[model samples]
Target chain A: MVKTQIRFGILGCAKVGRKMCRALELAPNTTLYAIGSRSIETASRFSSENFLPSSVKLYGSYEAVLDDPEVDAVYMPLPASLHLKWAVLAAEKKKHVLLEKPGASNVSELEKILDACESNGVQFMDATMFMHHPRTLKMEEFLDGERFGRLQYVFSSFSYKASPEFLESDIRMKPDLTAQGAVGDLGWYCIRAILWANNYQLPKTVVANRNPSLNKSGVILSCGSSFYWEDGRVANFYCSYLTDITMDITALGSNGSIRLHDFVVPFQENEAQYFQACNSKFINLSTGCEPARSGELVRADLPQEALMVQEFANLVANKADGLKVGKKWADICRKTQVIVDAVYNSIVRGFEPVEIMS
Target chain B: MVKTQIRFGILGCAKVGRKMCRALELAPNTTLYAIGSRSIETASRFSSENFLPSSVKLYGSYEAVLDDPEVDAVYMPLPASLHLKWAVLAAEKKKHVLLEKPGASNVSELEKILDACESNGVQFMDATMFMHHPRTLKMEEFLDGERFGRLQYVFSSFSYKASPEFLESDIRMKPDLTAQGAVGDLGWYCIRAILWANNYQLPKTVVANRNPSLNKSGVILSCGSSFYWEDGRVANFYCSYLTDITMDITALGSNGSIRLHDFVVPFQENEAQYFQACNSKFINLSTGCEPARSGELVRADLPQEALMVQEFANLVANKADGLKVGKKWADICRKTQVIVDAVYNSIVRGFEPVEIMS
Candidate 1:
């Protein structure tokens, strides 16, 4: 029997925020208690349709939801640039916070949000949806061991230019607001993959750089990042928003290399291809192979969001500390900022290999 | 209509020289006249029995065949370490010379051989049978005219491992002898590809680097070369013996990218693939697809060996100069030497990008 359910009040009744509302509706020991948006009509529609009786509350503004003593936490799906401000504000209201990906503009912004949670005794974490996907743990398993052999190199490239419909001069386009586009949108995904393989340890002296020309914004929309792990395994990542959307990662090891296609969105069949190097001969580990099926998740499965929500519940219910989760979020945010900043700086200064300031 | 056929004398009867015998056996106006090996029995057995020449001459000493006035030209496939030594001797004897892949051990040595050929007034050219292929002109057609779009990048890689039969003590294992194993073997092939595409124009600057720990000798066995063509196209190449054999070149233009599969052997059955950027999407240009048939030499049918041999015949038969041929040979040889040398230097100096000294 479930007791002591944690309720979430979603801020910003945007598309992602609405999706989170549906996820909360299905989650065990959770309920969508309230809705908040700048527009009262949007919040009212969500609250009335999803919640029953006094369980439903509508707010004309985000601050109204945070101020409500009845709400335990608030989910922040505002623009990436506004994440830090809202997260800190929610923490100040003693409400646990689930901030979306690119968690805060950079490392320092993430730290400030985390600090607010600490002082106010509230939980704070990034709602990186990929993290909630269980198969991601399978990828973690693949890279965790020496089964693939001593890692030599890593290659990842994620790309997709925003459709004209999506490129509506949003917060993402603001250079100072979003720290550029591709780095936050696609590049962060690659960095997370690297960190996952590196045991959450940052690379030693990364040769990360980027050159995003052609994108109108002064920010780099194309970037190449290189990571040199302590173990001498080098990882290189290529990301571009001026291209199509696809995720691929290749890990070259001493004995064989592993190529995980659709890594960002692995086969619903969960296919993984292994390439074995037989003393200079590359033998395909999977030839004419069918992709293994990925685990099926409900539309509201919302694993990454669910995990962030669950972690907050554990912190409050079990009195568990969220130091590790907050720190990892900070680390990812920090490296991404350093890399993207270096790339733009390098390109501006003639595309030299700019050493990451981090 | 038939005239006196050009007679070929082979020294060392090595693998390449043996392959030369087989290719000459297929040649239209060519005859294997004589064979010379360190051992007379070896030469005689190969010349009389294996090759089955109408009249065969065998010589135990290299100079004996070089002095053969009947032998119009010599295909010298000696060990890489011995190429310069025998090439000079053959040139001094007034025999038209066909040196294998790397005409000289080093850039300085190549210059010295060039000097010898000029002073002796004897025809000399490197036996890069690939250039003889008829398909090269087709590729030239694309790169020459503003064919598709501005050429921005070129990526080429060629790799293959040693057969299990390779002995550790073989000359391929000797550092000083086969100083540039992968670089000279595979790297030279790619360099030729770029030069051929650029119509013999030198790149403004060549930035080269390679893996340090992978090679046994200090010389580069795996190399990466970046070239800035005089017209502003950037070409990059990768070479390795430690990877699978991939003789593919991807030329990315503003509007599209052309993929040449088996570039060293371009006349394959199918067109590899072409990617064109359209409407903010890359569409694979499989618009024109057809089956292959024998006796059909499309753009890919560049009778590489035939051209080199014919050029040699033209230069020798007319009592004319091979200066143009020599110049091209010298360019490839010198550039290969420059890149191989620079890449090794880069690795030794901590994987730094080394500038080409050519």
Candidate 2:
């Protein structure tokens, strides 16, 4: 029997990568065939520690994994700082791609990846796993439906609130390392969700404000931005290392609203939540969890192994659209980075309103 | 036997003021002796409507209430826009005062009020009515124990999300009429709680950012403010008329954390909550309102009637120094106004960090 299931290749031993490996191994018909990293020892160690069925192959360099005929797609879990370089390379190698989100550091870099993937026949998906989640889809439906009434306001925050020294030169903290700092890292999801719900249209004006410590490498510690969309939707996006709150989204409309109490992490425990708008009241229907995927399997719980892996397997095996999936990932990356960069620039120029670039 | 209960007079029949009259009637020893407003007809109607006995004098002008010999203290349930004006006037008449929250429009206004109260040897207290409630005291005791370790971060939001026509000159939308917009109205409690918890110390710095909108009086709209205190505790305060959420204060510390869920509204019908703490191992403890207050009250149930009236009764009957109560209230009120003004100044200047002054 010619097995039609797409074989997955793990690239890099990042925390996200290690977690994705577990999911690839679980999905039916999916095969975790190989592991690759810069060092042979690291790749070999990950395969042994994480992958079951020791038959999983280990390769010294990422190129060797791409060369392998057994693996059909690559899961680039490298830092967002390096997503463009590897994603473009994987497409040139004729391998499909599922690059972790904040898909690239900037527009120019993401454009290179998008052009490369289009030139090649293989699929390239920016793994926004969130876009695939059922809850967000339901939220989008309500936002589009008359139930939410005319959309008036949106409030979202996805801040890690890490210290200055947590990762000194980490891409999330340094502008030089990543085109944007906290705004893109934590703020990307917020910006993208707003853009996605409002359609592909752009905002007419963007005013941003930032607070950066002079003691560091001009990395923004806290940033707040207000974007006035072309559709007349005015939004305020806040991301900070200064305030900590749950990751969620609430779309407030004229008559009523819908809130994903855990919009950021949908599969908290294989918890399937659906919304039913009957008459005036909207109800949140949740299926809690099963004994099989309960406890640590919950996204809010430690060891968020299943959710990340399932998204990886779907992208690799499903042949998801590079333009639909990959372009959006890069697009969000750019929009978030542009706004993030604009905010810091506004702060530098004394809180001047900065227009976000395309 | 001398029956000395605090004889109370209320000025203004504002929405919140009518609520205060009810609270005054509930206190054990207090008498709602007189009521005054701008119109004698309105005052008479209020006196009759509230079912006040005919002996409870009705006055044509607020000044008549201030001068009435039977009136021991004045409770001003006027708009935050007029707190300072009435508070000062009441003090000048030697009437002890209970000024409403966001205590004044600016520091200078509150300063003048304090100065007058001091010179006239009168008592004054800002109506942070929540603090006098048992829950606030209970929560503070838990936070102060330091078992949760040093307070790290605080996330608080107070919003109205009311319609555009909420009021023709609603202070929420118009910054000039309200001085600083929602930050003065809603964000006051969040700021007051932080200042109260941290003691009467200055924050090292504060940064603010607000949404763009034309207030009725051309006031600013939504805003975000971050404050860093001398002790390294950080707090983020968000306020808006475009969106409203239940107020929550999550004080995360070094060891564990204590969350005062639903921090603002004192009334929760079936809404019972308690503290539950845990480390890496076993569960610590959990306690909440096994006994619930009737959730029907619209924060209209503040013990202001009992506490403020009792304090006044004590001063008149026991000859206690009005100095301590007056000074603390004055200090809290002045600081809150100063913070509100600083936020507005920062927003006008594009959310620049400013030093809070009182």
Candidate 3:
């Protein structure tokens, strides 16, 4: 039988890479073919530690993975500063790219990688796994349905308390590696949530909250931003490495509202839940509310990461079969990066209101 | 038997006044001594509608209720513009005052009312009924305990869609009657919740979100504000008259989080609930979290409003027995008003960051 599954090569053996490796194995339309690390010994150790099948290849350098004609795609989990270089190189080699979040150091660097993908006619997507979750699809329906009326306010928060060792030495806290720090690493999810709730409509202005917590190296450890639209819509988000693990999203409409506690990742892999209240009102004498909020549970056939991987593989397959390259994922990634850049700009400019240009 | 119960007089027949009338009847330490409206017929109608006992006196004017020597305290449900005048008059007449919220139009006006209450040696408390809920006490304990660790962030929202008639004719939308509009009406509760979560420690600065929805008369219909503290604590709140009814508070600490959907009023009058997650963490591969959040239910023997009235009556009785006036409620009321004032000032100043004075 002729093999039809897309072959995936992973560049780097970072901690997050292990999850993607599992996802590639779980996705139905993808095969985990190769993993490349700076050293062959490191790649070999990662493959064994993760119990990857011996059939999978181990390459000593990222260039070797791109050089292999059998590798159809690459999942890059390199640090943010290196994304521009390796992502462009992978695209130049005509390989589909699934880049980890904080897609690049800034929007300018991200644009370069995007241009390379566009020219090479290969698919490009950031590894925002939640976007592929079935719960997210249900939430989008609720926001679009009449029961929810029109979206007016959105608030999201994503934070996790980092250990003392991680804070002191993690690449995320190093200015040279991840200059955007918490805003890029965590606020990326929050900003994506806000934009998703609004159906990708960019806010007119972005203003950073005053007094974000920063480390000795001047990397943001905790931060937040307020967003305003021309139609009186408003949103705000907070992301931190100094608070408890919490991923929450509350979207309030004109007539209803929806709330989720674990938006970025579910409490469980197979099932996720969200609470919705439609036409809720105060009862007589304003003593209490009518129609208590109802929780909706959504079950997933595959974990969200696997679903994301499958979706990316399908898009790549469709393109190979003469379909137009999918621009949806790329568009979403660019919008998220724009807002992330604006937040950083606002912080650098003393928390001024940074006007977003489109 | 000698009369020991404090006698209460209600100063208006507003919609909210109906709730307080029920509260006064439910409180064991108070008596519904009298009700005053614009006219004797109106007062009589209100008394009948609320099923007040015949022994409750009916007065044609507010001054008549204040002049009644047997009336120990006054619950004023008048509009925001009238609170300063009526509340000060009630206090000057030796009647303890339970003023409805927004407390007054601004902090300056509230200060004047506070001064009158202090000079007359009468107890003063705002009708923020949620503060009296047992659930609030429990939540506070969690916030202050070691499990929750130090507070880092707070987000609150209160909103309700108003009918066309209300938008056109309600005193709350009139500039003269309630100039602060939705910020004063709905934002009051959100600000109070944030302040309460932080133990009434004021933020260092407050900045209003741009483009607040306003009526033709320039009364705010929707608005939000971001608050910052010197120690990197941050909070943001949104309030509106154009969205579905929602009262939510999410307080995040270093190690735990507490969230309540109906923070302003319970979904059920007899019991209130909140959710808390302590020491939650992502499990292996970040597929799921460990120790899911837990829900806590607190039963109330009396409704929150009734509890508020009873607490105020007890303070009045203590003062009557030569105990010094209780200052805690007054202090909280003042702190809430200062933040409220700062929010309005920031809006007026084009969303500038207004420094808050402690």
> Could you give the C-alpha RMSD of every candidate to the true structure, in order shown?
8.2, 7.3, 1.4
DockQ result, candidate 2: 0.13
lDDT of 2 by residue, B1-358 (tens): 3346777888976556655665667666667888888999999888777677788788889999998876778888776667767778888888877776666777778788888887987777776655565566655666677554555555565544455566454444544446666677777877777766566565767776444444546565556576767555666665556543434454554443444434554324223243324221211111011111112212323343355556556654543432244266667777777777777777778757797653
- Which model, 1 or 3, shows the larger TM-score? 3
List pairs with backbone clashes in candidate 3: none
lDDT: worst 10-residue window of model 3 chain A = A1-10
Q: Which 10 successive residues of model 2 chain A have the least lDDT summed?
A: A285-294
Query: Best candidate, TM-score-wise?
Result: 3
Interface CA RMSD, all predictions: 9.9, 11.6, 1.1
Q: Cα RMSD (Å) between model 2 and the true structure? A: 7.3
Best by DockQ: 3
Across B171-284, the per-residue lDDT of candidate 3 in tens digits comes to 998899888888888999999999999999999999998879999999999999999999989999999988877898999999999988899989999999898988888888
Model 1 lDDT per residue over A28-120, tens place: 656677778898898777666645346668889888998888888778877777887888899888887777667667666767887887788
Judged by DockQ cut-offs, the docking class of candidate 3 is medium
User: Relative to the unseen true structure, what is the C-alpha lDDT of residue A135 in candidate 3, on a scale of 0 to 100?
Assistant: 98
What tens digits encode model 3's per-residue C-alpha lDDT throughout A1-358?
2235989999999988898988988999999999999999999999999999999999999999999999999999989999999999999999999999988999999999999999999999999999999999998998999999999999999998888998999899899999999999899999999999999999999999988999999999999999999988999999998888889999999988999889988998999999999888788899987777778999999999999999999888888888776588888999999999999999999999999999
